[model samples]
Structures are given as C-alpha cells and as structure tokens.
Target: MAKINKRRKRIFNMLKSHPQGLNGEAISQQLGVSSRTIRSDIKALQDALGQYNIRIFSSPTKGYRFSQFEHLSSIEHELFKDNMSNLETSKQRINYILYKLLANTLNDISITQNDLAEEMYISLSTLKIHLNEVKNILKKYDLRVTQYKTKGIKISGEETKLRYCIVDIKNIHLENEFFQDLIMNIDTDLLDDIIKKVLSERKLQLTDRSQKKLCMYIAIAMQRSRNNKTVVYPSSLTNKIENTFEYNVAKEIIENIYNQLNVDLSCSEVYYITQCLLASKKLIDVSESINKKRVKNLVNIILKEIHEKLSIDFTNDEYLIDGLTLHLNIALTRIQFQMNIRNELLETIKNDYPLAFQMGVIAGKIVEQYDNIKINENEIGYIALHFGAALSRNGIKENIQAKNIIIVCSSGLGISVLLKAKVEEYFHNRLNVVKVLPGYEVNEKTLENIDYILSTVPLKNIASDKIIKINRMLQKEDVENIENKIFHKKDTDLMEITTFFN
Candidate 1:
C-alpha cells in the first residue's frame, strides 16, 4: 500500500535502528531477496536521496548506513520519497549468484540449477552465464562446481582449497555486515584479548585493518576446524614455522579458542594460523634473520632491470631499497603460504599509473627470476607504489622554475623517467619534470611547487585544470596533448615556428 518495496523499507528501518550498519546478507535474510538484490536496493536508495542532504556511507567490513540524517523520525518519512525501482543489472545478478554459491559451499549445502535461478529470479539461460563466471573464479582457488542429475550443484575441492575459497569470498564482500556479524559471533572478544596480549608481548603492531583481518582469519580457522575441516600443512613446513615466535603466539591463540569456544586445534591448525601471522607482517626477530645477501642481491637485480628498461635510476633511493627489501621479506612468506593481501587502491593505481604498472610487470618478471615465486598483480601493484614514490623523490627539485611540472605514474620509475626525457627533449625550457609520483602519493601538499600534473592515470576529484593524462609511452598523440595544454597552440604551427627560428 505504501508503494515502497518491502525490502527497501525494511533495510531503511534496520539501518535507522542499528547506526553501526548491516551487511547485504543480513538485509537479504530479513527481506527474502538475494544479497545481490539488497546491494542494488541500497544503491538505488542512495541515488534517490541525492536531492536530500543525506548520504549512505559503506565500510569495507561493515556494510552501509545513513549519514547526515540526524533526526531519527525524518528517515521513515523519506524512506521512499522517490519511486523505488527493482532493476537488477547483469553484474549485480552475477555477484548475487557468487555470494549465494559461496554461502552454500561454506555451509556444505547443495542447490539445483532450477532452484538457484528461481531464488535469483532469473531465467535458466541468464543463470548459466553467471554460473560460468563463478566457475572461473572458483577455478582460481582450485575448486569446482560438480552437478548431479538429482542433486543440483556442490563445490568440490580439498579442505584447504575450500577454506581459501571461503577466505577469498570473505574478501570479495569485505564490507558485508552479515560476514562481520558472523566473525563477531565466533567469540571474537576473547580472541581479540588473546591477540592483543600476544602481539603486545611480541612488540608487534598492526594497523586497524590488519588487526581486523588477522582476527577474521583466526575466527575463520576456528570455524573450519569446528567443522572438522582444518588445513593440513606439510611436515617440513610445520617444523620450520613451529620454531618461530609467531607460531607460539598462534598456539596460544588456538589454546584460548579451545578454552573459550570449546574448539580444539590440531598441530596443523596451529601451523596454518602461524602462516597467516607471518604472511601479514614481519616479526622483528624474523626480519633480523632474513637473508641479507639474498635480499640485497634481489634488490640490486630489480633496480638494475628497472634502470635498463625505463632509464629511471633508483640505485640512490635508500628509502625505496629499504621499503622494497622489507616488503619482499613479508611477501615471500605470504607467497610461500599462498596468502593474498588486498591492494585497496589497486584500481586507482592501475588507472593513474600505467607506466608504473608496466614497470611493475617487468620488475615482477625479474623477481620471479631471482626469488622463484610467481608474483600476482596485487603484489606487483605494491611494488609499483614503491617505484612511484622513488621516481617522485628522485625527480623533484625545489629549485626548478615556475614551468616545473610533476609526472604521476602509478606503475613506477620506468614510465616517469621516459616521459620526463621525452618532455625535456621536445619542450626544452618550456616544461620541466620536478617530480613523478604514484596517484596515491600525489596530494595538494605535493602539488605546491607544481605547475602541471602530467599523469598516465586520471586524478579523480581534483579540481586543478593543470592535470593532464598521457599515454604510458609518450606517443605523437601524447606530444600533441602536451603541446595543446602547455603552448595553447596547434603542434604543427608551433613546430614550424621553432623550425624557422632554428
């Protein structure tokens, strides 16, 4: 009778009461729609509120909530001010199916194809397209969807593989309130207490995100173990990690889980948790024992490769070298254990730092040659950040004149240096490269001395007209773009004028 969808009104009411927020799953369960549909409804609601002075804020781990709505009574009045639409985009439907399948996998449930399609309110043809995508994603974790004639589909893989899928699925919806709630229901209070004590005693500090992730993984491990699905590490690997301080901390945490949650952990479970801790950060003692010669040699090799490929010299960048070495130590541990770290700004980096991303790709090959572990895009993205910073530091000089410009390359040094060389060669005294930065590092403060921002990536939300996006490798089109911006003239006429003068 209200004309508002029951789900939309219900979600609004829930968020109104729970200021903290709720994940998609929590809203879906109450509304009887897929989490995918809930996500779409939230987006629609947010768009509808554009006329009002209200906003919806989402947390990477906490779902969504209303912002700028101080009066509680005002929310219900505005619940459906605009006509609510129920259009589910193809992408949203795919995400919904992924969520549903992963949820079913975690709970060891099976679903028929017909039932899945019916639940998602889609046709069999559309459902298959989404399922194919899900299958591809699952393949990355070495899991597969097997179907029986009578029984719909179930995820099949090793216990470890299944758990990794679960972890990945958790990461995919990091901002889901339902997932956060699930993590909270697993005796997190006691787990956090034990973690704080262990980390404090070890003098290790983790950022808030890192701390949340560490706790979540521990909780996940406990849950899986309670389900008799503990990860089994190789004997040699277990023996190696069992001697470390992290292992001791993990063992203590597991013991506490037993005492508080009544879940007993096998040795393998302890070992698996240790790998999670080691993969997250480097322990002081562990850092001290890292193969200095090997790390130094690897750094030198990477630097040399970067220089050869891009003509960007980072040999003198002590900060870059030190940061990279430290990162490598932690990265190797994560790689060894097949743990993946999220690069939250990866899209921004890729879009803003094409040159740097290329440098990362080349550098990744060099690391694989030396370190023997294949590097994924996420890890390479981090590598690009270091190079981007180093490129900026190496190029920026305060004495450069008013024509000074900073190049932003999200990928790293190779593109920055190449672009700077091209600009100097072509523009001569017209423009100068005072700095080259990654997108994430370029801020208002960094732009103080800058006349123009030449970037391979877009600088979103920046009001400055000085920002220019260029090709990763300077092309004729890119040169023309620079000419148009800097000279305010056609390149052909400008070149003719310079040619006549020469």
Candidate 2:
C-alpha cells in the first residue's frame, strides 16, 4: 500500500473514533508529523478520493470530514490502499525543497551561495552537494548550473536551448506538479496588470510578442546573473523589429515620427514604434521589398549551379526568397552572438556564404566553438536564409516550378518517419513531400510521375526515371550524397550568372 493511503486510512480511523472529526493540528500531533506534512497528506487524500464519488470536506472549526465515504467503490478502496506506500520519503521531501530553492535562486539576480544556503536552511557543504547534482543533470542538455563565490548557482545556456532543457528536466523529474501548485497560488491576472503598469511607467507599450520574448529573456538573464556572469544582451532591437514586421514601411513610419519628435532612435525607442505599427488600421504592402524580377533572376542562377554541380531543380518562388532572407539574418545574428562580436553582420555574410551548406554549416561551426554545445541539423533555418541571400546578391535569374517527391520505405513506419524528418530538416522549404508510401503499397503507376523517389527498400518495379536510394538511418554523408545526386542531372536548366544583389 502507498504511504499516502496509509496516512489517509489512519486519518479516517481517527475521525471515526473522535465522532466530531479531527482538526489539522490534532491529526498532525496524533500522527507525530508536522502540520505541513499533514496538510499535504490531506491534499493527496482529496486528490485520490476525487476519482470516485467519495469526497473529503473541511470546516473551519470542525476540520476535515469524509462527507461521502459510502459512495467509494471497492476498486477505489483497493487503489487508495495501494497508494499508501507512495508517500514521499523524508529524503525526497528534502530533495523537493532543494529543487524549489534552486529554481527560485535561478530566477534571482543578487542572491549569493551563502544566501541560498541560508534560504534553503541547509549547511553550505550540503547545499553544494545538491547543487553539484543539479549541475550534472543540466550538463546533459548542454546547459550548466554554475556558481561563483559572490553569487549562487544558476542555469546558463542559449535561450531556446535552455527552454528545451527546462522542458526535459521537468519531464524527467515530474516537477510540473510542484510548479502547477505554485502557479495556482498566485493571482496571474493581477500579475499581468502589474506588468502592463510597469511597462507603461517605462514609456513602452509591450506588444504580445515583445512581452513574451522579454519575459523569457528576463527569466534566463536572471538565471545567468545568479552565477555572477554577465548575461548576453538581446539582439539589437532594430533587427528584432525588422524581422517581426518584415517591412521597411513600418520602419519608415517610426523614422518619420522620430524625426518630427526629435527623439533619438535608441533600442528602447523602437518598442513604441513597434506598438504603433501593430496598432495601425492601414494595411501597407508587407511584400514590397520582395522584388519578383530579382527573385526570378536569383532562382535561375541557383538552379543552373544545381544542374552543373549537383543536378537538382528548386522551383524558385517569391516565398522561398523571403523565407531564405529571414533565415539568413537570424543565422548571422546567432553567429555574431556566439562570437561576441557586435555589428559584424556583413563580415559573416561575406566570409561564410561560399560554403556548401551555407548558414547551417556556419551555425555548426559556432556550436563547435562553445563547450558542450550541439546544434542539430533540424535547427538550421539560418542556413536556408543564407542560401537565399547568396542567390539574391548574385542576380542569377531562372524560372523553375516547384516539384513534390514521395518516399517509399520497407523498413517500417518509424524509420521512414525518421528519414522524412531528416529530409525536411536539410531541405527546409526547398522540397515538397506528398507522402511516404510503404513499399507494399507502391505501384509503378503511383511512382511514374513523382518528381523524385527516395527509398529505403530496393525498388521492385522502376517506374520513375529519377530515383535515389537512401539508408533507413540518414547520416551527414548521406545528406551530402543526396544533395549531389539531386543537383547533378544534365538536362536541368542553367541561367546566366549575375550578382545576387544589384
């Protein structure tokens, strides 16, 4: 039986003997446990009983009562009986408290190691041991829980990386229950109001996106600050605005207003401009920067290079150009941030664009420089953008229609899905996948008109003129091979080379 069930049974027994019911203090005294422990036990019992028609209620003067005990099923009784032994051990309780302390300290800026030990009611040596364990857990996700003599232990990593790391940790340790309880106790609606007031005081109107990003940044910054390391500043606010708005018109509006008001366009200055742009009733041309002629020319050059070098056709479209440009800027920003270099965007583009994988390769290089950091191929949006930017600058014009490919696999659904994910990761917006057909379901008729064929199993009937065999598990070399095969066909169209940017 679980420990909680045993405690609940004991409480029910006590109430039955008392007739009027036992108050919290009486139960705690009788059970030889702290009031807090008893309360927690009561909550656990309530949760357990709630699954059935059984109900436990509390009266301010009379204390907790089993109001509908008769309605409980034999199965419920058995289940509750089984849960008696699951009550947390004293050591587990200590660990829980220690985890909470670490989480809170990670969200504070000025707390020191000594301060943390005091707050957690533990000796410095004991605190250090607990912190070391937390740090080891954090290291698996390429994050570190660092401590300084002047500051307490705190988590540090890239924002998105750290967010995912936290998600992992929460899943592993089942810490969501504790967080849920903590959040439940707070007035979140009131907190939102308070945040709005705070932003208003700073003369900033926090848009939904800014509010969310700022919150995340502040949380992570505080975590890093607790380790006595200077937190990295967010990317230049202008870049964020441009990426979010994706138009110069919004920027122009702000620039004109600032000129009239004589307000210097500082990082903080853009916040209000973003708010105004979002509030505007007028719908300006968001795609005005996307030049169709320029995009067509760039697409043609890329297609030509693919035909001569690797033999693949990417139907160049306006969407691809916009997507690629956005990705490129983000990649450049990430590289600059990693290198701790400010205002070196042009240098990053000039030096890295010639590489085969473009921004993806560059991002991998940056990740290699950081200790224990790993960049998965799935996170290579910036690489796609770099390719787009390169094409734009070279001004090679081509018109190619986008094509769809269906993969066939006999290695089962799981492996087929993995390969599909890898293909999507590498190709980004370049490839359109119609579906993954199992080898048994594949027919020559179905495969005849497919743009490309990727298969884990040997083709029984070759119908498609273009077919590429890939392993069930995709590797880096495999991605390169696939790229080479797709771009090396002779009949693919080539375009006259021109500068990407005019």
Which candidate leads the pack in TM-score?
1
Worst 10 residues of 1 by lDDT: 281-290
* lDDT score, candidate 1: 0.69
Q: What digit string (tens of lDDT, one per residue) describes model 1 on residues 1-502?
A: 2234445666777988878877777888887789787787787667656666578898868888888758557655665543223326776666666666666655678889887775555679988998899899889888898985687898788876676666767766777533443343477777877776677666654433455567777787777666676776777877678666677778887777777778777878888877778766332224332466687778888888889878877887776777677767667666876776666657766987777788788878988987788998888877776666565455444333448888776432333444565666566567867755555445677667777888877776676778888876577888888888877878767788898785
lDDT of each residue in 38-127, candidate 2, tens digit only: 787777667766666566678889887776555443545564443323324544434543345435544454446665554443468876
Count of clashes, each model: 8, 33
Candidate No. with top lDDT:
1
Q: Which regions in candidate 1 have their CA more than 4 angstroms from the true location? A: 1-96, 118-123, 174-184, 243-245, 281-290, 395-502
Against the hidden reference, what TM-scores do the models get? 0.58, 0.33
Clashing pairs in 1: 23-177, 60-175, 352-457, 353-410, 356-411, 356-412, 357-411, 396-434
Candidate 1: how large is its RMSD?
14.2
